[model samples]
Target: MVRIKQRYILFDILSPPSSEHWEAYSESRDSALLHLHQVSSSEISAKYLLQVIRQVLQDHYGDFGAGSAGISLVVKYFSPKTSTGIIRCGRQHLDMIVAVLALINRLGDKEVIMRCIHVSGTIKKCENVSIKRDKEDIIRMQRKRK
Candidate 1:
């Protein structure tokens, strides 16, 4: 029996206008959290992300190459607070998925950038790393408040 291996790619979502948008959050923690939630709410959901990935793959590889790649993009976890998400796909198509991720320049006219920060074979490892990063971010933010 062949064990089907999976890969998880953790990524950060950034918009071109982030600097201007983030400036408003600098004033207060409440406002920051509120703005974070608002931005998170505005992002592309897992379903739409998958569609975009497929479209990108199609555009890059053409119909036959895309189909032959056997890509299946899945969102395992996404957190707006951290502006991070985890994607799951077969090990074989990891390159294809990464390529599509890099190729994505916009999401619904938002002019966004998706940067893959980490890739792992297990979901638990990815979750742990994401948690650690979230904690560090919180610590950094708290320090800046002082």
Candidate 2:
């Protein structure tokens, strides 16, 4: 039997500074994302994120070159609150995935940063850690709001 190993990469996204009245403008997660990223839509679905990542990979490596890299990537989760998400990919493609992630400085017209925070062999571990970190981020945001 042939076994395939997969790795889950967790990352946080940082966006440009919002206007002073950002609170008033951000009615929903999508709204906030749209405002922050200056994109036509606020929905950062797994499919959408994957498309963007693939585009980056393609840009760095031409279509055929990217295919030769043998990267099997998927987005597991994405949260606008913490700006954190998870990606699952073949173990062998981790380095290439990281490189592409590092090169992603812009999403649409907005300036952003995609910072990888962790990597794990299992999705459960990634989810647990992401939940913990997300809670901490929420707490920090609350403190800042006060």
Candidate 3:
């Protein structure tokens, strides 16, 4: 008997702020506030996101990398309202997937950035972290607006 270990990656995607917003955020020194694009949400769908990731994996790592990394790949959750998602992959290709995710710069016609927030061995932990982070993000964004 063999235990097939898996890793759950919690990630978020953001669309670059419109050019007007970028000019404004860039001038402010509060780099602490990374709103360079405080995009409230986006139009990304799970199907689109999964497709982008898979394609990028193939492009950057080639067929072999894509085949191995995608063998167990699954997009577990995606919320367009939250612009967040979770993906599960085999432990062996954790770094490969992360790298491929980072390489994804655009999805559909929108320029988007995919960021890995939390990685854990269990889906529960990833979900918990994402919820907590979402709350914090809302609070932070509200404060920035005030």
Best by TM-score: 3
Candidate 1 residues lying further than 4 Å off, grouped into runs, are 18-38, 41-43
Per-model CA lDDT versus the true structure: 0.76, 0.76, 0.82
**Cα deviation in Å at residue 94, candidate 1?**
0.9
TM-score against native, each model: 0.79, 0.74, 0.84
Q: Give the TM-score of candidate 3.
A: 0.84
TM-score of 1: 0.79
Can you write out model 3's per-residue Cα lDDT over 1-146, one digit (the tens) per residue?
99999999999876666666767567664442465334434557777777878998998889999898988999999887667889999999999999988998877677778899899999999999998987886787677789
Instruction: Give me the displacement of residue 55 in model 3, in angstroms.
Output: 1.0
Question: At residue 94, what lDDT does model 1 achieve?
Answer: 90
Ranking 1 against 2 by TM-score, winner: 1
